[model samples]
Target: MHRLYVEEITETDGLIRLSGQNAHYLTNVLRQREGDNVLLFDSSGQVFDATITDAGAKEVVLKLTLQYRPKEEQSVAIVLCQGLIKGTKMDYVVEKATECGVSEIIPFYSTRCQFTETRKLARWNKIAIEASRQSQRVTVPVIKAPVSFSDLLSMIKNQTDSRSYIFYEKGGTSLKSQVLPDDIKTIYTIVGSEGGFSPQEISEAEATGVTALYLGSRVLRSETASLASVLLLQFMFGDMVYS
Candidate 1:
């Protein structure tokens, strides 16, 4: 069954009206017709089975029924603090990070970042939503607006019950040496841009209780590092465990 993201699916036992882009996506893009069954998910982490009742040009109505709700909430939340990279590379990071089960993404501006004034939160959120729909994630990751590198560090410093790690190519402790606390609630994985992080930036981050991590000897691109770090964290602490 096809899945679509609806911001809010209020009436679970009745008809729900979808207009504008939602309607266009179903009726036009997906060629959905009346009687077609579709799955709808909301930000509340609820999935509903929706049957298309009417597939009009501008409006599509769905008959909704409660389908699934997560049995338990995720204990560990993974957040990606990605340095702003070039155009499409940043988009790729957002898309793949969402698929990797990141709970939130914060784009930050650093000294070595090429695009300082880039603001693509809306586009990134769209990509996240689409990725969530494809990945069968009931909840979409929150993509925050770009912030200064200092602000990012401050945010990590102020967070409670969280462990932040900055992946630096220069040198840092290996992941194996660092024993992650089982009770840690949030994991912040910071990845630098194409130019990577400066020595001063890494020092500031370290002062804020952010541990410097090394992803082996090989250097990776900004996007690759972001995805790799998040996936590794997810497998260790988040929801990517073996069945």
Candidate 2:
């Protein structure tokens, strides 16, 4: 079923009035008509089966017929703390991570970060939503604004229950050998930029209880490392649900 993320919806009200871009997309782009059934996902992670009750020139109305509530433990939260690299690498990470079911993406600035601008959250969020829609995910991943390395460590230090790993290009424990924390469902992965994190940055993250892990012998580019970390963690914990 075709799915859309709708903002205004209620359990009591069965009809969803879609206007603006939504109406235009469904009517003109998707060529949806009245009686066409589509799936709707709300911000609260609620899934609803809806039919196009009206696909008028002014608006598109959907009548929700069924609601599916996800299991309380159905999700395994995976947070990606990525160093901002130059070019479109960060954009690729956000889009691919969202497609792979990353719960949140934290774009941070390390000493070697090449991209220092922090004004791309809106664009990244748009990519995340589009990726979620393409992946048939009910919830879109949250893209957080960029923060300094210290600030990133503060956040990571607070996540005592999360399985935290920072991928180091140099010597570090192999990811395949480390045992994932069994008590927690939250996994946090950190990847450095093009030049990678400095020795001090790695030590700071390590002080916050982040395990320095290696992705094998081959060194990966910044974008590839970020995507690979998310894929590996999600594959071990959450991606199977989406698959």
Q: Across residues 1-243, which tens digit of lDDT does each residue of candidate 2 receive?
A: 787877646644668788898889888988899999998886668888999989998799888898888434235688988888776777888888888778889888877886576777898987888888898777877788888889988987787667788999886887778676567768889888889888888888888888999777898998999888887776667645443
Candidate 1: 10-residue stretch with minimal lDDT? 65-74
RMSD after Cα superposition, model 1? 1.5
Candidate whose lDDT is highest = 1
lDDT for model 1 comes to: 0.89
Model 1 stretches astray by more than 4 angstroms: 71-73
- Candidate 2 ranges beyond 4 A from true positions: 71-75, 239-243
lDDT of 2 at 55: 97
